[model samples]
Target: MSEITNFKGEAVTAKPENAADLEVEALIRSVGDRVRKARDLKGMPRRVVSELSGVSPRYLAQLEAGEGNISIGLLLRVAIALDLRIEWLVGGEDPWSSDVLRVADLFRSAPAGTREKVLELLSPEPPEAMRARRICLIGLRGAGKSTLGAMAGAKMGVPFVELNREIEDHSGMPVNEVMALYGQEGYRRLESQAVERVIAMHDTMILAVAGGIVADPDTYNLLLSRFHTIWVKASPDEHMSRVRAQGDTRPMAGNPEAMEQLKVILRSREALYERAHAQLDTSGRAPEESLERLLALIEDKGFLT
Candidate 1:
């Protein structure tokens, strides 16, 4: 019998029965390496990837350790969450050596302004023209995006939409129920679909999206290219107070370090939020006052024009 090295580099008799097993084992290790490399290259923590992909941290750990054989369905979810093509994860070729992937990598690492320039160069329409008169408000949950967006829409004589509500309507269930049933990966897919539906239905409207929408690069980039975006911001204290004012104490119900966690989130997402075309600070201000400023901002920015 011919001796061959198995996946673990141990010498073994090369039998036809185990040859297939060796190939499968090699494929598993290759997938695990690619997944780990992709995650590291994106600078995403395992927990963050798990949260976005709806995979458990322990499972991700095992996969990266080259021990867990993930399902195709779950692997596809991870690919989408990473904004990567599924083929990139499973293909036999080295993705890093591909010119297409190299360009994509460069684009992802480019500055926001540079990315916009590249988009303008590549797109058939100018960014503003693609956006038309549509506006999107993005920020933390308690940042008054919804309240101010609706008020602005009403006063400006345009349609207003809450993306979560859109997701709920499409799924025939509430947002929380959708999350409970479908997990983060499913919810994100629905969210992306909702954005597409809104864009197709309305060329001119005001839309408010959830805070975590920015976490998905593909969806967020689609938003940036299709709408005039604003970041509605408030202090951590204001964010907490506003949520509590709405009688939702989930942020502090059991988490004593909630405020600290909130701050950390804000700090982490600041760069992403800053990608918005404009910003409105609503901290220490009444909703009406903030709405007034938001309307003024829209006018000043000529967003509707």
Candidate 2:
């Protein structure tokens, strides 16, 4: 728990002198933080939430600010009004994960089937089906996009472009340098610009995209509209093994929970990844075999002249 100022300006918690009490206080504050996030994400203002929850705006503010010792009944009412699970407020599950955020806003207002139909209607159809001139590959980092994209480009008589390399070239530095100089947000800003440039410059090419491009809905949707998207999927173990085989040990060097974090990210992103025109599972297969699968998917989708 955070300490509040006393009369003499000294900081103190309310009777939290024991370890268990401190833990309880911390949990209360954490729950408050989560409540605030859910409420904000649901587009519920304090006054509206208070009216719906029958808890005064002042109390709601205090609770959201982590200062109110709110009752369980009141908290439950708040949760219901916000359309959020109590377990999320209590931090059992991450409500802000991509998995939750992707659906939470929609699910709060509509059913799952309705949401799917809405998305299908909103998404634009590619002109060439899977034989689009702007062919793009998407997947986890260690997927065989680069290998297969190059080979596919060779067979199809078109150039292959790596979006990351394009990003680096556009930024006038390496991608790592861009991240270091401008941070992830800046890097992502540049990434969107680079995607546009790539689309404009290449009339017919195979594009290899960043693994986490799904995290950016705008760029990913742009790719979907303009390109024949193929998701090259591999098992979690294979993803880890492939990255490791490339001599990059940073994922596990200082973090023991790397694999679990990867699993969480994959779980959060799998649905978004499935939005691609086709999926190729590359587990236990050579790059050449994976390329064959990718070619088959493209051919089956009605490649044109």
Report the C-alpha lDDT of model 2 over 199-295, residue by residue, as the tens digit. Answer: 6566678899988988876677768777888888898888888899999998888999999988998999999999998888999999888778877
Candidate 2 weakest lDDT stretch, 10 residues:
1-10
State residue 131's C-alpha deviation in candidate 1, in Å: 0.7
Q: Write candidate 1's Cα lDDT for 248-283 as tens digits.
A: 999999899999999999999999999999999999
TM per candidate comes to: 0.62, 0.57
Candidate 1 global lDDT: 0.86
Clashing pairs in 2: none
Off by over 4 Å in 2: 1-131, 303-305
* Best candidate according to TM-score: 1
Consecutive 10-residue window with the lowest summed lDDT within model 1: 1-10
lDDT of each: 0.86, 0.78
